[model samples]
Target: MTAVSDRRPAAADPAVAGQAAEEDLRSLFGQSTAVYASLAGPSHVVHTANPAFLATIGEERARTGVPIAEMMPELADQGFLALLDQVYRTGEPYTGRDVRIVLSPGPHAREAFFDFTYEPRRDAGGDVTGIRVIGVETTQVKHAQRLMTEHRALLEQIARQAPLTEVLDGMARCIENLAPQEVLVSVLLADPDGRHLRHGAAPSLPDFYNQAIDGIATGEGVGSCGTAAHRRQPVIVTDIATDPFWADFRHLAEQAGLAACWSTPILAVDGGLLGTFAMYHRTPRIPQETDLALARVFAGTAALAIECHHSEQARQAAEARARAAHDELARAVRAERELRAEAEQRAAAAAELAARMRAAAAAQAAKPHPERCQLGGSPGCTAPAEVKIADSWGDSAWGCLAHAEEAIISVRSVFIASEELGGLAAYLDR
Candidate 1:
């Protein structure tokens, strides 16, 4: 339709005008989550506020006809009151981008951010009357940016092969700090057999609590971490005191100041159980969507670190085994070479003895008897020849009984030639 046709009818119905007015009011006062408030006079007395404005400042303090400083006393010290005053006095609009403020006081306080404007509302004569505040909370967006930054740091740490404990501990602290609500993170690693859970890291947990839960068995009703590890899935125990899975661990949990735990099992790419990533709460509480999302993101990170550690361990073990086998094989080869060398030496000695015996026999033919023991060494034996020993080569020798026996043993082919007055018979008789 053309712009002229889309214009309001020349004669509009009264009911239609009232309905349009009501819709406009709804859009201004609510129907949108942006914080809106109107303050009158230099004192900045709150004239009206939208639901979003009341929610941000707290609904309990919601009221009109009161100064903004009194309703949000915390803002006075944060420089926001001065900004509003300047806008109203000078009639110059002021805008703040990513302005941070603490929403409440003391322990109940939470940090929030906003992109906001303080604009002067003027009369027909152009004199400033009041200030109109329009703001949109950027708290969630700010948190999301922080989350991505922290998550990136964690991924870098894992990629660099940092100590598993360091990576896990850093991740736990990151979640605890980033979460909108208070959270204590615990990581438990699963044994190879998937039958037990060993404490991995829990920076914020009490030492006693960590000790008590270390080495817990994985099975049904074995608390959040164990059960999650056993089942290889997420187990959300909104209240540990009442959950059957925590019956065996109730006292420890209570002492540790933990009222709730939500655990997600960390798994390998092959779907094998690696460990459990858990978030503990101080009060009985169910996890929000953001909480679960944070768990999943970090749980995957934990798995990556663990798998890398395991792979490195396996590789080192394999290298050790290979080195051992190489050493053993080298030793065997050396022993075999020594044995072969020894056998060759024995054969050479035997051949030399056979040649000597043949020469000795030829010399004996010249004189049937010798004055000294022919079998003796260069230092001839004074003892009489007592035995005649011959080898299969027909080489014979006359020697004392001791020398004869020595010849018999050293030359296996040698035997008694004949028995004389002092021959082989003497050896038998003696």
Candidate 2:
């Protein structure tokens, strides 16, 4: 027997569920990391703004009761002011998603993106009065996606074993392009012993500046990259002009228009110092969270790239050595084979020479020694016979000193068989 209880969870009310979802959306894009503003009249004077809005522009320019275009004059050129005016005139709500914006101008200008809406506020008479502005800054998210794309590309380059110089140079250029403010990127590779840092890549830096810092010693107070490599950590030089680390390199830095340098040491998986990754700024400024984050991310990427390169180089070197050793061994085997053939040829020649000597001895057994240079051919040597030469097959000849020595050298196994002879050593002594 089984008993069943008739109990079930109640269904959520459509209106109440909808309201809860709306509140969460508002909290996400309105109260947190979003800009809210109220404008007055058709002229679009700034009536009020949330703290996020003030922070988004600049805290120093937090004063209200003024036109936003006047407060942020750069935005006028960027077309946001025109969009606001159109909303005020038409009384129609306008929305934009992931719109690119430049927050400031000049060399140190910052770039941003925003998803925003401009809703026309109505009066009691049903006439448009002002505009309500709500915007969520999407700069970080957009930049993060872009960074991931670029970082993945770099990893692919490493996996494919791209040249180290090409990888590093491309990385420097990519960072310079993506940084929020004007910055130059530089990479310095550490020497094998970690005693010095050599210029790896500096696409935006001046040639003179790059050359001057090439092979800089890795030690304390030796500029940003060198010091970072020496310590195997990040080194922040917010003001190159004031930092003691840049004391020696101050002149070079000034010539290159560099005011700040933040460097991170690219380390191997085993925690050994590999090289340095640096961001150079035109204006003196402290690093923000994003700036430090970028350094850490790219520093790791640089380490991966450098380690891959070293491994590839080592592999190539090993292959070359193996090829050389194989070639040498092959040559040695060929040489041994050739020597064996030559020795066999010499043995055959020796056997033939011995047979010729034996036949000549059988024919002239009684006259083994001749009187006047018997070894001469065609013309007879007039010199008196001086020595006798003989071969192993019982053949002998008597001849002048010159013919005797010549016969002994030309005929294998032929030796002096003279009863009276003066050695060359005794003759030279006399």
Question: Against the true structure, what is each candidate's TM-score?
Answer: 0.78, 0.81
Model 1 has an lDDT value of 0.84
Model 2 regions lying over 4 Å from their true place: 1-31, 366-430
lDDT of 2 by residue, 1-430 (tens): 8978775334376546534543544455555667888788977888777778888888877668998877888888889889988998888899999999988667547889999999887754568878878888999899888888888999999899889999999899889888877889999998999998888999999999999999899998899888888888899999998999999999999999999999999999999989999999988989998899999999999999999999998999999999999999999999999999999999999788656655544544455455688788788897878776666566667789898777766766675553333211111100
Q: In candidate 1, what are the lDDT values of residues 213-306, reduced to their tens digit?
A: 8889988888988888888889999999889999889998998899999999999999999999999999999888888898999999899999
lDDT of prediction 2: 0.83
Model 2: lowest-lDDT 10 consecutive positions: 421-430
Clashing pairs in 2: none
Tell me, by TM-score, which candidate is best.
2
TM-score of 1: 0.78
Native-to-model Cα distance after best TM-score fit, residue 79 in candidate 2, in Å? 2.5
